[model samples]
Target: MKTCFIVCPIGNEGSETRKNSDTVLKHIIQPVCQELHFQVIRVDQIYGTDRIDNTIYEHLKTADLIIADMSEYNPNAFYEIGYRHALGKPLIPIMKEGTDIPFDLASLRTITYATDNLDKASAAKERLAETINSFDFSIEQNEKENEPVHQNITPYLLKIQDEIEDLKGIMLKRNDEFAKQTVELAIEQIQKNTAAPENKFAEILMKEIANDPKKFKEFDAIFKNLS
Candidate 1:
């Protein structure tokens, strides 16, 4: 799960750029990134809770790639791009149709597309995906290859990230299991006392859960407190 440090201006809901950004995210960025196995993180998603400067810098230093939106010639976006460049991180610079690329960065690779056209946005996504796939990571790999300290710790950090994703999936599965068990438990409790006729399907479900209570253990702690 490689990280993509997204540098863009987060505008209010009514702003045109915000609308455009949403289009870019849905039609361009998300689909392409999902294919490349990159987790997208932007300042809006994880910033301001900490010292703003430090939070952005930490992500810039660690993310595997940066996809910078230079759409507005935004000072903050450029500042982040400068910091990323200084760290020698890989980046893909993208901008709206009319935005200027800085003279100094004129020689660097960039993607420019129409924000007003969904068709063009889709085309640009394929181009951006191709550009990302073609990037040479040999420089970063070679440097890590020579460092014994980095070789050991880098793997540890990656494993921790992988485990975090796994735990998220496990937590979701348990939550779903608990909800199903609670529904069955409620059905059983009602059937135990109420004069109302049981729904045959629900009775079958309660019987199934009773026969396999171990699978319903996630609800035990919460259900135990009930009368």
Candidate 2:
């Protein structure tokens, strides 16, 4: 069966946004894939992380196409989608109504639907199914044959699989350290000022930083001092 990557958000049960998005995705997306004999691989279900992990990269390398929901402009979602675009993979970018499509992706084709209404979701699903059915794998093969060799990046792509694994290991350890320090700092701050809101704010900020390493480095000095 042909494989497709389905990128979307997954969070705790309390997260209404993720819940609603998953509901529509399972209801509309999976049925279409079944009919077309395509396998649907949801990144979250496979990797158990919101960000693109090594498993996700491996899946993308094999996927015939990617169906990405950019409804929330989620940072990780955008990152994964961008990676797919870089690989020249066929992509279907979809969003909920009223969400501003990012400027960088504005030139590409996309589908917008109203998640609040089932009718709109159904219409969008039908359109996407038709689009998927119309894909010609022969074109993909021909394009690959006609593509020029990129000597510079070809070596990097060859090593990317191993590099990504090493990076994930480093990131997991770094995030653990950050989380431990964050909790200690929050407790210390609370002890200094029993009624202060700073600790609560710090907790929120630290959680965000733990989720994204790029932001963590921005406050490297602070974290170093805390160490």
**Which pairs clash in model 1?**
none
RMSD of each: 20.0, 19.1
Stretches > 4 Å off in candidate 2: 47-52, 139-227
- Reference-based lDDT, each prediction: 0.66, 0.65
Compared with the true structure, the alpha-carbon lDDT of candidate 2 equals 0.65
Q: In candidate 1, which residue ranges exceed 4 Å CA deviation?
A: 137-227
TM-score to native of every candidate shown: 0.58, 0.57
In Å, residue 41's CA in model 2 sits off its true spot by 0.9
